[model samples]
Target chain A: MSSSSSSSSSTELSIPLHVKYIQSLGENKDDLIYHMTSHLRLNAIYWGLTALCVMNRQDALDREEMIAFVMSCWDEEAGGFGAHSGHDAHIHATLSAIQILILQDASDKIDVPRVVNCEPSKHIFHSRRTLPEMLTEGLPLLVILSLQQPSGVFAGDAFGEIDTRFSYIAVQSLSLLGQLDKLNVDKTVSYVLKCRNFDGGFGAVVGAESHAAMVFVCVALLAILDKLDEIDQETLAWWLAERQLPNGGLNGRPQKLEDVCYSFWVLSAMSILGKLTWIDADKLIQFILSAQDPENGGIADRPGDQPDVFHTLFGVAGLSLLGYPGLETIDPAYCLPESVTKRLGLRKNWKALPKRT
Target chain B: MPRVTSNNSDDEAQLYCEKSEWQDITPIPQYDGINPIAPIFYTPEYKDATEYFRAIVKADEVSERVLQLTYDIISMNPAHYSAWQYRYRTLVALKHPLDVELELMDAFAIKFLKTYQVWHHRRLLLTALRSSAPSPLSIASKELAFIIRALSTDTKNYHTWSYRQWLLAFFDDEELWEGELPYVERLLETDVRNNSAWHHRYFVVWGRVRAEGEIDVGDVLKREIAYTKDQIALAPNNPSAWNYLRGILEHTKTPFNSLRTFVELYSTQTAPGEEDIVDLDNPKPGPGAQLPCAPALEFLADIHEEMGGEQTKKAIEIWKSLGNEYDTMRKKYWEFRVKEALSV
Candidate 1:
């Protein structure tokens, strides 16, 4: 499915029947796009796996070509990432590419600064604008803050449900853009702090089950800002470690089966804390390796499973962090290169990690 | 399959990602080290790992040969405790009650005990116990004691923690308050940072208090809120602390007794800045984005209604504190109300 089909009929012909069937199932493509793209936890997995697709072809397709191909998953108009070609943009995919680009230092390859600083997608010419514009018009923050309605929140220019996960990412993206210096962290953290759950894991809101992936966003937001001390370390560690399954994987919740992407959620958290050794690294790596489809050079959630790029990335990263031979050792603390993390000049514990006021 | 991303508008803008990102997956550089990974995957040594997986899937036959093979796999990799644990999950999921019962107790009582998985299995076992019609409390109590004995099995065992809550849910208030509350108290004493213990403590005494008509409502609210604050102090990013605090806050209105506390929480904490970055508004103006802010306004109105007139007054005060003076707030609020009413 070369995106350069140069013919509209080509792309329409390639729209797999299975995908059309999936869309026909109740949810509009918009819902599917939102669900997949919003799962920011699996960002690296998406790109890493997508990279395998293009890179596996060898020098025939260089890394630059491969990345451009993968970037197509990012919905520029809506500022989200899709799972694959033709999917809608979402937060999950957005985080995936962001992680991939950051980890790869591919920011230069892409207009990283532009995308990071891309303001709330408001004021687009809707009638003349395309579907992406129609979708980008949904950014809940710019809607509310824009005061598009009568009330402060309701009147904002964009419209988004003020869930904790988005709240964290919304702030994080701002922080990532170095817009935090001009922004009010006090007011932002104050509002976010309310979304904190008593389980010691943050959620979409208070009283919700403490999800692992969301916890990563909450913890990472604090960690990146040098505010790790605000988290209940023992509680969070316990919650995170508790997510590891008997199958050598981590799950979002207890009683749930382990999945491939949780490797990033649980592992990244452990890496940040210098606590990767607490879990059985060999067992986790073995589980991850078993999920890989050696034939396709991509990984899956379980053995003999359909291969995908997202799982492949996490599975490999999981292996790398265990000091696996020949694999580049990931700085588990930030789940990035020791060199790159150093380049960021991250503090001993990321930063001051001040107790949340 | 979905080709929604295709378009010619940003053709030159298709940015490329870098290559080093893939290094974690195909780490060719680090393989030259002592503990290599790729080769091991292709090696016969990995067969030992699969052998155990087969044994668990085959454990039901009860043949001496099958039992021995399963036991061998269990012994071969104590580090792969998850495999041992999953073998137990499959067995529980299969609901072979009698088969797992004695074996499970022995597994829990093993010389070198690890209950992270065993406890999870025990929870499954307890949940499954009812269909078998034996009230599973005896086994649950036994397992709870084992969890206490092997607290070091996994200190962060939410499996063990929640199971205790489940068991307490079945128990009466008198027993829960008099008997279990003390035990949870003992847990919190041992490890104040144990969030499960904190949650258990909240559910035990405070839950009973709620059931018994809010006895010591103020005290319980103060205590749990303090604990939530303490948890945030310990791990500011912990969502659960915020969760438990919200639960306690919702369950106990006494904490919101004064306007000061309400303003402190609302102005500072309540839902923060837009996290989702959703494009909720059409932004085309002119009937395009009509009443996009209705939900938020409705939410505030609902809160105002819940608090009666008191909250509305507090809102006025908060507005004033936020720099919108009293008279201006009063004037604008009424004016907005008039317009809103007239529009309706």
Candidate 2:
């Protein structure tokens, strides 16, 4: 491979090496860093697994064992999953668990009610069709729905701290579980529109500054909810395209240092808006490739920084969306394999760049 | 490496499982022996601490000992939401002094500034403090001070900024909202390109719709536009200030051409030739400032486009310059803008 040399300018992604890095992550049981990051274990697993899948190397990690670990993190009392075993249930960890299970074809492990599959009228609040009784009972549907605040935002957990991120998670989780029928779509969407700033970007919450990551959550949520018409797509797309820096990497916001992760966050939003061609794809591809640890085999936040699963996943996911060669397509809205979303009938109108030869 | 004698004297050396008083509590391991998948091999310290935590939670215990355990666990892992939530419950149940707890959390919050749970825990504490304290006003002031200190470390930490916004609105006190603009000004003075400061300025200025008799909305919009122009004068390249300028215009339903001359000053290609022009109404860029600045040029294009007919052609010309010369990085976007405008 061209990566044998120490130069950071290698133009090709070290897919084999990244696969090795991920495989090695599970072997370091004695590493204290592993234990310290237990709170993010499930998320880490999802990242690692999704990265491997995008690289067309899904078998890099053991599927059965991964599924078992996800199930083990389930908080039986809360009807949601925690980050790890013995950890309390959280909305985020629950989403990770659901994603992992669905990817592994083990979603039946999640005890969602059968009534969730019935689709209701679009954006119409039926007087009789309220929160489903089965969902209100101990189930993942209730666990997610209960977190929605009266103002249409969502708290991360029972702790009552709210963010637009939780709203996206809730939307995605409900959609994935086939329970969109129960969601108060107008109420949920009203709050997101409130977070829109003049720059045509969304924020983490109302009155917060627009950020690329928050843009992804809000835009993706709107896409999933089929509420994209509410956003000013052209203005937002222009703002997103402006995130690309001279170095080719994109920043989360204006005047911030470019990081590899925004390649996904910014690109995903643009992709959903059907404006993926607004930014320089070739330069961004080069930038994402440059952030790879050509030797040790993981992508970092930037060149010369330490590599981790989160950035590695985002790096690959970004490349996949940019039509990088020899990778599977990723759904810009779902952040899952495009195939997975299609199979689940949850794919939205988001577009990825055409796959390269 | 062996445990040092000096470290042994501190609470760090003690094991929760080894303590005599905790003998009644059985440590519940994370996984059963039947099929352990990807179990984390925790250090003796963390393993013992969490196992005890699991046991205490299972036993429904909320005491001082549980508080100490949760704190130790949290110190080791700040993202431990369960530990933070459990600790908060324990504090509330025990009727512990939350003010003292907030004082202790200051150091921890700084240490774990990036952790979501740390900020959320602070929010929970303040919410609790709001009801228990005799004067929520003092708590609000103290929190604002603490947030100012925190912002000194990271001027744009999303959590800290949002918390400050939430604090002000939650208190709904005039004094809290009154100091916010100056605070935002100080932050902007430190860094003109700080988007968070610009955003906060907008939040404070236009956050709540004023009653008709309270303040003149037109005057406020005028002042905001002027302030934004002044900041834009400091750094014409800053998108944040430019966006704020446009934002103020959009919110007031003001036409873009209203700032045509000011936008023209920054969007012009030719240099000012060291003429030292000082105009407060429409300040010119500094000597070293890059002329035909991209954001300014974009704004200028928008202004022209807003005029329609013959002026739309002028907008297309500026956008063409942006795509073909000034800002080729987003050449496609500018081209799209041109295409959209031509189609219209």
Candidate 3:
């Protein structure tokens, strides 16, 4: 409970995990996979980071080993990804793999057309599609392929239901690649809008409970679509602000304990919308720094735990998004490594295209 | 039940066992002397390094003394689940007691439930506990209860719920366990926006059913959905109740009753995610412009048919309030009639 004093700024050293394990989960056949502990949404986040790690400049050999471990759990026949190999083909894993592949720069390795809005077989969207088109073309196609049906929302596997949160993932995956146009944007938008609950943030889908994590996806999707103006700014921001506890970490849900990861999800969206000012930046950064591996130079998902590559990347990403010193200012719309984005000279403002002919 | 893994060693199992009880152990006299204690293994010189081989790497062991020192160093943090985890993570197939240790491995598991090490440790602990001599049921049950108690403190505790579900399945008897389904329902009553409780409730239903063996899932889910509606009726502004209801209603085999409840509950949630301007030009508008009340109008139209009566009219009002722009809201404007048929 002790606070960081002026004397401790230089004295504090933070270390998130240095490696991430982005393993392969699905294919037309089985491959290497890592069994997720449980909870699909979280498992997906880990896989997402693993995929991101394959591209990290600082990722160590253990990162590759971690990815290999996750890949070992893949169910080759499902033609998609899962938290672990042999587990169901959840959209969470599928989208995670796609992003990781994008990070790996192995986007070509994936049969893109077949996955994005390509019914039964189309993976590649024509080059003419807007950044939204190209993005929506590939990822949501996989989401469509994976949909359980009648719901129009995405299912984790073919057999799973069209759960709410993933609609955010499915849509965000498209947004990440700049392809919101490939799918029926109206339908996707409406579906996501319905998932909004009394709490003023988006949930997994219609009538689902609003959660801080899903709020991230919901706001992120809208932000990517150039539709930030659509959300209930006051209500959503209140919810986001309330997520910060007396201790300064963000929790995904109420009465729930806080985690370092939520700081990224909840605050990043707030940062994008200009609502993070209420959060104690100094305290949040301190909480994040405390979660670092005192032994190694990375972070654990929470303090007093072992460091993993996923949390390490995100913890740093969260701090970077917070405009922590030395770290580059993060671009939320595009989750590009701030350092890389800064080097590439990207702007903080997320831009949208004009009317499509 | 051990899956393919990188850990397969007696030393790994031994360290996991010792880590479970280090919480009550004596503190190192030197721990207070240093701001952070480095691994004692790194400082001590090894005598016999040949025994440290992990088998997969085909390298000689770092030395038994080094291994013991590392094990002891890792054991210092009773809650360092991954330290205990990585110690056994060499081949990924290490023999370990998963449930017992996982029950004891609360801090790390609770804070970082999604980590590979926490999970692998739990899985190893469970697998080992199941195979342990005489089986520590009392120990296992006590830990499960602790998880449940911790979950009660925070319903959205995914890690606690996940691990608790794993244990309930092994323990069996929904009738015997009374499962926490009713408690979840009660919590929902108190706070319609309680997502963690609702999430935990979903797993509770799943766990109870596995224990009970074929209770009416649809009827039960319907009851659960009603619980959300009750929340909505009380706090129309609460989005969590609607989200919880939506989670229950969206899936097929989702009882019509639950579907009914979602439509019933969604009345207040219609304009969610909005706190500023509402442009009449685009009733659906853009993100953050206004609450998403208009976009759900059509979906509500469909959902209300299942709900019947005033619920349907309420759905129409929600739709009409979005402003009188046009016949449809689509990018390419798929003929709704044709698209509906094709989509079906």
The best candidate in terms of lDDT: 2
Off by over 4 Å in 2: A1-9, A108-138, B1-10, B20-24, B32-35, B274-277
Worst 10 residues of 2 chain A by lDDT: A114-123
Tens digits of per-residue lDDT, candidate 1, B146-193, equal 556655565555444544555555443343345665666576556544
Model 1 lDDT, residue A226, Cα: 65
Better of 1 and 2 by DockQ: 2
- The DockQ of predicted model 3 stands at 0.03
Q: What is the lDDT of residue A291 in candidate 3?
A: 82
- Model 1, global lDDT: 0.45
Model 2, range B224-311, lDDT digits (tens) per residue?
8888888888888898998888888888899988998898888887656666566679878877888889888888888788778899
Could you tell me every candidate's TM-score relative to the true structure?
Answer: 0.40, 0.92, 0.45
Residue-wise lDDT of candidate 3 within B136-161, one digit each (tens)? Answer: 56556666666655666666544455
Taking the tens digit of each residue's C-alpha lDDT, what string does model 1 give over A1-357?
A: 225452432111111322222223223323433333322323534344333322221222234643553454543444455444323344434445555555445654453112211223542332333322333454422322332112111100122223445545554444433344544455555544544554556554332345677677666666666667766675566567656655677777644568877877776676665555555555566677667554334567776787554565566556555555434444433445445556666423521111111
Looking at model 1, give its docking quality level: incorrect
Query: Which candidate achieves the best DockQ against the true structure?
Result: 2
Pitting candidate 1 against candidate 2, the one with the higher TM-score is 2
Task: Select the stronger candidate by DockQ from 2 and 3.
Answer: 2
Best by TM-score: 2
List iRMS for all predictions: 20.1, 5.9, 17.9
| Model 3 per-residue lDDT at A166 | 59
